[model samples]
Target: MSTSFTHIFNGDSTAEAYAHSGLEGQEFVWREMVVQGPSKGIPGQESFFGPRRTYFQKELGMSAESYYSLTEEEWHRMAGASRRGEWVLWYEYDVFCQFNLIALLAGIHYWDNPPDRLSLICVGEDENHRWNTLANFSPDQYPKLLDTRKGLTHDDLLYAATVWEAFIQKAPLGLLPFAQTPHPSFPYLGLAIGYYLRQFPQAHNGLNTLEDILLQEIAQSPKTQPQLIRQVLLQRNHPFGFGDLQWMWYMKKLQPLWLQEDDHLSLTNLGKKVLEGDTVYREHLAGRHFGGATALDYIWEEDREEIRPFPEK
Candidate 1:
C-alpha cells in the first residue's frame, strides 16, 4: 500500500545524506523550525503559522509565500504520510531536533489512521560519549542505522503530544516529569526537554544556560561572528545542535551585552556585570519570546530546576 516506505528527515542535509545512502524510501525533509515562534494552540492551523510567518520574516527575512511553499507544504505531506505507508523519522538528539520530533509526533498522534508502522532513528552519542552525526556516516553504515530504528507505540505518541502541549503553553514545569522519566523508545527526549526548561533566565547571573555559555565563551576568546559560531558548535555539541542561523539570532539578541570591535565580539561592561552577578540582564528579555510565552514572564531557579514568574519591574 502507498509507497512501501517514506523517510522523513529532520532537515535537508540529513535528507540529502539518506538519498546518497541508497535508501529505497520516498524522502521528505522537515524544514520548519518549530523550536522558535508561536505554537500555543493546534500546530497545523493557519493561526499557528501566522505568528510563525511574521517571526521568520522579521528575524530571518523569509517571505510569507516562501514560508507556505517551503515549510507548510512539507508539513501537509508529513500528515498524509501516516496513511500512505510505514514511515521512518530520521532525527538527532539535540534540542532543535527534539522539539521538531515532539511536534511531528503530536501531528501523527492526531492523524486518522495508523500506517503499517511508524519508527524513529534518533542518533545521539557513542560509547565514548562523543556526539554522533548520522549524515557523516559512510553509505554502508546507513543500513545499520536503519536497523537501530525503534518502532513507536501508541503511548509514545501520546507522550509526545502531552509534551508538545506543555511546551507551546505557559507550562514549562509540566515538562519536568517527562524529562525526569525517559521513554524507552525516545531515549534522548528527556535530556533535550531538560535543556529547553533551562532556557529561562537563571537566578545566579540572570542569563539562561545557553546565553551564559555563549557570553562566557565570547569573553574567553573574542572572535568575529563566523569564528564565534564555529566555536559554539564545537562547545555546545550533542544535545545543543544549534547551527549558524540559530547562533545568528542569539548573537543579534545579545548585541546590547556584547561589544563589536572590527567585527569581533566581546562582553561590554554591562555584560561583564551580568556575568559576575553584579547586574541582572533583564533588558535581554525585552523582546524575547519562548514559544507561546514571553521570556520575561519567568526566571529560572537552577537549584530547583524550575521557572518562577518574574516579578514586574
Candidate 2:
C-alpha cells in the first residue's frame, strides 16, 4: 500500500481547523475528501504536504497557522514532500512506527487543554496498527482525560504499551529500541526475547541467550509461563523446529497477557519492557559467537548463501 492514504482531513471544518492549527505543514499529504464527513478516501491529485509545518509544531510548539504564516511561498516550496520525507515517514510509520510518539504523548497530555479541546492527530507511516490502537483508546481514558481531569492509570499504560509495540515493531530504532523488519526471524527472535525477559525479571550480568537462560543455575526452580519460555529457549540448543515448537507451545498453551493472533502466536504486554531492557545490548554482550552453531543460524545461512558451510573452527 502507498504510504499516503485517503486524506483524512474529513469535513471542511476539520480540514480547515487542522490545516490552520498545525497539521498542514507536517509532511501530511492532503487531498479532497469524498462522502463529506469523515470519509475514508485516498489523497486526491491536488494534495499538498510539507515539513515546515511539522518542525514548527513539533519543535516550536507553535500553532499550525502561526507556523505556516511565517513561511512564504518559497518556504512552502522548500517544504514540499520529497522521496526523503516519504522514506523517513514510512520508516516511522510502516517499519518501526516510532513517529506516533507525537500523538501518543499528545493523547497522554490531553488533559492539559480545556475539557472540550480537540486536536488533530495525524497518520504516520504505520496507519493500520496506529489507527487501530487509537480507535481502541478513544473510548477509554484518552477521551475521559479530555472530559474529566483524571489521568491515565496502570491499565492504561498496559494498553498503551501493547499499542506501542504493535506499531513500534515497525518503527525506527531511535523511536523505539527494537526495530522489526519483514524478516521472519526478526519477530520470532523478538518473541523469544520477550518471553525470556518476562520470566527473569531480575537483571543479571554477562551475556545471555535463550539457551543460557534456560540452563542457568538459578532457573531450575518453578517460574511463570513467561519465564518458562525464556528458560527453555536459553537452555536448549536444538534443531530449527525447536524455536517454532517453543513459540507454538507458549503461544498455544500459555495464554499470556498479550494479544494473540490466529497464527498461534502472541504478543505480550511485557514486550515494551523487553524492548527497554536492551536486547541489542544483551546481544552485543553475548558476542558474535554466542548462539553457536544453532539450527536457526543454519537456516539463515542457507538463505543467504546456497552452501551451508559450518562455522570456522
RMSD values for the candidates in order, in angstroms, are 2.3, 20.3
lDDT (Cα, tens digit) per residue for candidate 1, span 1-313: 3347888888888776777787797778777677665566556666667778888888888888998887888777766654566788998888889898888788778766866688999888888987786666777678789888888988888988888888877646677788888788888888887787677788877788888878888889879888887877875654667778887888777888899989888999989998888988777677667776677788888888777777733
Segments in model 1 whose C-alpha atoms lie over 4 Å from true places: 1-3
Q: Per-prediction TM-score, please?
A: 0.92, 0.18
For model 2, the stretches where C-alpha displacement exceeds 4 angstroms are 1-139, 142-208, 217-220, 224-310
- The global C-alpha lDDT for each of the candidates, from Candidate 1 onward, is 0.79, 0.28
Pairing residues by index, what is the TM-score of model 1? 0.92
Question: At residue 26, what lDDT does model 2 achieve?
Answer: 34
What TM-score should be assigned to candidate 2?
0.18
Candidate 2 lDDT over residue span 39-151, tens digit each: 11111111111333443354335567764443333233323423221211111111112212222322233222221211333222142533222222322333332232223
Best by TM-score: 1
